[model samples]
Target: MSAPTATARRSRTRWFALGAVAVAGAAFVAISVSGIGDNLVYYWGPKELRAAGDKAVGATIRLGGQVAPGSIKPGDGVSNLEFDVTDGTALVHVVATGVPPQLFRDRIGVVVEGTMTRGGTFEGHRLLVSHDNKYRAPADKNVDIKTLMRSTAGLEER
Candidate 1:
């Protein structure tokens, strides 16, 4: 073919490159869309999660709330841990076999990532605790407000 019709060859090469890019882009989009359905993440409170009926099984989700006080129980054997997560109104049982975070404790905000079991328990593979905001104070009505005000006087307004 030699060097004949240089402009025609250049135009053909450009079209081929453009077509290849378009095909690759389309394939990427298709794969992404298909994978998204399996990766859908839903956040639900403890009570709301229990109300999800049978549809909760086989679906991955995040249980967001505090671990219920006095509801934490270590597994009977050596490999599992069971606990109840509560959002004040409702509580759901959580069964996890993996090692949980060190900060996991009662009355602390936590988000457990895992799939729900058919027996109405969440099996967490990962436990994420929201440890940034934790304040402990007695709920007595007789607490001295004057001392609290004095202690916070030097702090900047947040």
Candidate 2:
């Protein structure tokens, strides 16, 4: 029998430290993956929702589409709203409760977050309006810049 040398002890210590670090890293990755999976909310459009069939029911998902031109209607409650969201191919009826955003209107793109009911209606709790970033000149383009500047010039010093 013989006692271990100083070099042997240092090598063993290094291996042990390396193993601990690997275990910690694995644990962190596992935790992060699980957290992300739990928080994930799948987004579906009208066509996708139709394709989902039974799977879409009872699942909390996000639906994105444009509000149908003539489908906005008052629901059973004051704040309740019913509208058809369409992606030009399919339409899904959405019933939402809460204050609709100012930009929420017919023909505007929207994304609603909620669960779909068994009766084929989406019960939404949150509403998001989508608008394009295209910029255009105003229709009334005859404004005189010098006159406008003169009007505000007196107030600029204040």
Clashes of each: 0, 0
Candidate 2 has a TM-score of: 0.60
TM for every model, in the order presented, reads 0.55, 0.60
Global Cα lDDT for candidate 2? 0.76
Task: Specify the highest-TM-score model's number.
Answer: 2
Model 1 residue runs over 4 Å out of place are 1-42, 76-78, 132-158
Off by over 4 Å in 2: 1-42, 76-78, 140-158
In order, what lDDT does every prediction score? Answer: 0.70, 0.76
Which 10 residues in a row give candidate 1 its minimum summed lDDT? Answer: 149-158
